[model samples]
Target: MATSSDRHRIRFTVHYDGRSFHGWQVQPDQRTAQGELERVLAKLTNGPCAVIGSGRTDRGVHATGQVAAADVPLRWSPHALRRAMNALLPDDVWVADAEMAPPFFHPRYDATSRSYIYRLGLASEADSPFRAPWCWPLLRPVDLLAMERAAERIVGDHSFKAFAKAGQEERGDRCTVTEARWAPWEGIGLEFHVSANRFLHHMVRYLVGTLVDIGLGQREPEEMDRLLAGEEGLETSPPAPAEGLFLTAVTYPADAGTKPPRRRGPQLVP
Candidate 1:
């Protein structure tokens, strides 16, 4: 049991635009989600605080359900912590919700799966300044059927070495893709949705770029198989732009931690 002054865990979900910020992780003199959150938390806790994140989202990648955990004073209720933290955070970043977690809880290692979505703007209207921040506007139409077929091939356990960036192979490139699909986006374009046990660096963006290439007839759909098989020396298309990607959710087993804390606004469900 925690004493009155003892430190326990607090888990929170943060939403960020990622357009102006450097990324999720902290870097010296760089504006980042984690950096800002840690700053405010340190002030609130009245000392140094290390905020651990579910993972590092690349620069320009947005997230609606990015999970992070930190130890704070035992008296800081999840609701009060969120309200206080949001008061000091900039408009681009906000704590959507928070929960009290076990001392052993770790956002990244405890996650059962992580989900991401890539939005493609197929319609010409996407060029509007208002719509440019969250989507990739394609100037030319591509075959949606081909993209769907390629997405189907991605639903399984695979090495994915070819899809990841160089040096990511040190941890091994295997990922178990439990769910993967392409769906229409409100009659405007298509979006790729995928959930995996783990992801290698830049794997999803690479997959999206490769699938888009196949849709444009730049490569055969069968190339997905070769990539999964870790075929050496076959290069992939350039990664999809970071703005098109969003971390939609993260899942954890019920036993992984404690019940979610109460909140005042619409909760960010994971």
Candidate 2:
């Protein structure tokens, strides 16, 4: 139990390659971001500490701007915490920044929006070995214009029940998607950017799969409205590969910080 005087809140950011991790949350017998972080925090503070993340990411999901918060009795400078944690965490996970936050602040509840980026390579050759672990490589050609048109259909608030995966029936399927678009990137790749108040499990990937189907002529763009309108008979889309997915950014109230820190190399844990 926490005593009144033991209350101390800290905020931090983490970057991780989800390919090597089981997921962000700690699980029994699985190496996860939360487990690694808690281990380091316990060693540093010489006691148990609970770390709360802004969101839960699935296996093989990557995050460049994941945020978490924890309460601990030990008081260490943010730089020190950053250095110490980086040393203890594995090379695949890096601590970007750590700072004090209002005691009432909670990473999950305080977040205003979250952004995700999905990359699709439009080339006949396989992706380079170095980039293979972080991107989805496609050899088949994709119709870029068709993908963009289908993507536009998902913008705005709607009941996304059809897009949601099975076993999420208890939670309503309404989601307010503020932005959804795909744009050509440099060379032979395209990027899909989506921002929302909240997301259903595998929502972005499902959307990507749906649009990719449209690009491939497997489905008509007009089918999107029926899908959104709770129509049945439309086939479920396949989730885009996890490697190309990244949790890019999370927004909070302005007072949380004017800007997030720049990405840097991993620090050594104490």
Candidate 3:
């Protein structure tokens, strides 16, 4: 339970299937996760409600633990508001949980780290209709050792300019990658898990594409070193298919939903 305050901030988690929506952000004449949420919330709040998400996932990128925040009228408790919104939202999106957040909670600003997992399937059955929507079906084995070696370089702070899409350098292309690793999935090819303070547009997909190519022996593993050098002359492979990407979690300051002036620990690690 949250005590009364000058402002009422609501924090919520959502899990959405991105196939039917344009992306996380609202766009003109587009179906988006944020748009759907704001619309339903506005109806419930009986006013214009703005829902701010932790990140802007690309089109067709799913999220199992997307975090967001909003300000609603003081009359509504967190549980009631969550139920109301869930009742009105479409089937593709589900409000996993909601809570009364502290007045100062801002979804994006208060987040300390975000984690994403990219799934790939190597078996011929990976291309099955049932599996294609969730994972990349390569249908052929890739060199896991090579990919792991390349991923090791991703740890630590560095300029990810090469892995991100262009036109974003205006915001400066840098991210602190605390963890980047590859692991075998349940009878699937592998899943790439990368946790970072922040990610640039298409950075994860591009890194996956390049790493896959390295596994295929199309590129050298040291290319990651050159790309992070922040100099020209190296380019990453095409971005991986968006369907394989899932935003697994967003790590916020522990005190994010408690009150104003959120307290944060060091970025997530280990």
Candidate 4:
């Protein structure tokens, strides 16, 4: 067995189309982002290799800047390991960057914040098969002003028990949202960008759903304040579909480790 000193920790920035897997975590008899990476890594190392993601994304949730970490043999350089993994990983997944990390780096705990984007499709073309899988095709106009006002209500620390799925209350629901906004997305519709220190299960989706309702004039923007206050007798709108959500980025301290060099993109072997 290799001693602890023989291993080197590597951090990776990953992207994946979520349509093909259950989620990011491993599961019994089901495909997952972590499982696939571990499978390929174990083969390369000739033994078991554990991978830890910055956080879990639910089924059908995509990612363009997710972060993960693993300890590997010191012989494998960051660039070479990235190339090898991309060669073996499934078509839907790609490693955008990889680099050496501090010995005790933990993707989740070390993260300063995580960002997510939720796409809304309001144009007719959004109904096309090419676009439907990546965004919510509501096909209806929404009050952008109302949504904006409501999103502003999210820009502070608050208990998000109203937005998150059950079972996480014990972990504490307070999240310090650093940024939140809704903006145009190439004229197709609106896209919501939010960044926070941490997120609870389905919290972003629920927020999107309620915001959409507010945009449609079904509810007032002040409802966001009531929800954030954890007031009783008010239920949040149903969570938006998972397919429309994407994990966009994860930030960390400046001293976490050296940033990986810029690469053109992932190159896969045919």
Q: Rate the local accuracy (lDDT) of all candidates.
A: 0.85, 0.80, 0.86, 0.89
lDDT for each residue of candidate 2 in 1-270, tens digit (9 for 90 to 100): 222365566788989989878889889999898788889999988977778888988899999899987776656777788898999888888988888876556677668899999988776433777666676777568787888787888888998878877888787888888889987756757889999988988888888888888888888888888889888677558988888899988889956533343433211121
Q: Residue pairs in steric clash, candidate 2?
A: 87-268, 87-269, 88-269
Clashing pairs in 4: none
Name the candidate that leads on TM-score: 4
User: In candidate 1, residue 83 scores what lDDT?
Assistant: 97
TM-score of 2: 0.90
> For candidate 3, lDDT tens digit of each residue in 1-270?
232353487789999999888999989999999999999988987777778899899999999999988777788888998889889999999999998777666778788999999998998777888888988898887989899999999999998888888889787888999999998877867999999999999999999999999998999999889888965766888999999999999997677745544455221110
RMSD of each: 5.7, 6.1, 4.9, 6.2
- Candidate 4 lDDT over 139-214, as tens digits, reads 9999999999999999999999999998997889999999999988888998999999999999999999999999
The better-scoring model by lDDT among 1 and 3 is: 3
| Alpha-carbon shift of residue 110 in model 2 (angstroms) | 1.6
Judged by lDDT, which candidate is best? 4
Which structure is stronger by lDDT: 1 or 4?
Answer: 4
lDDT of 1 by residue, 4-77 (tens): 24777889998999998888988999999999998998899898788888888999999999999888888799
Q: Candidate 2 — what's its lDDT?
A: 0.80
**What's the candidate order when arranged by decreasing TM-score?**
4, 1, 3, 2
TM per candidate comes to 0.91, 0.90, 0.91, 0.93
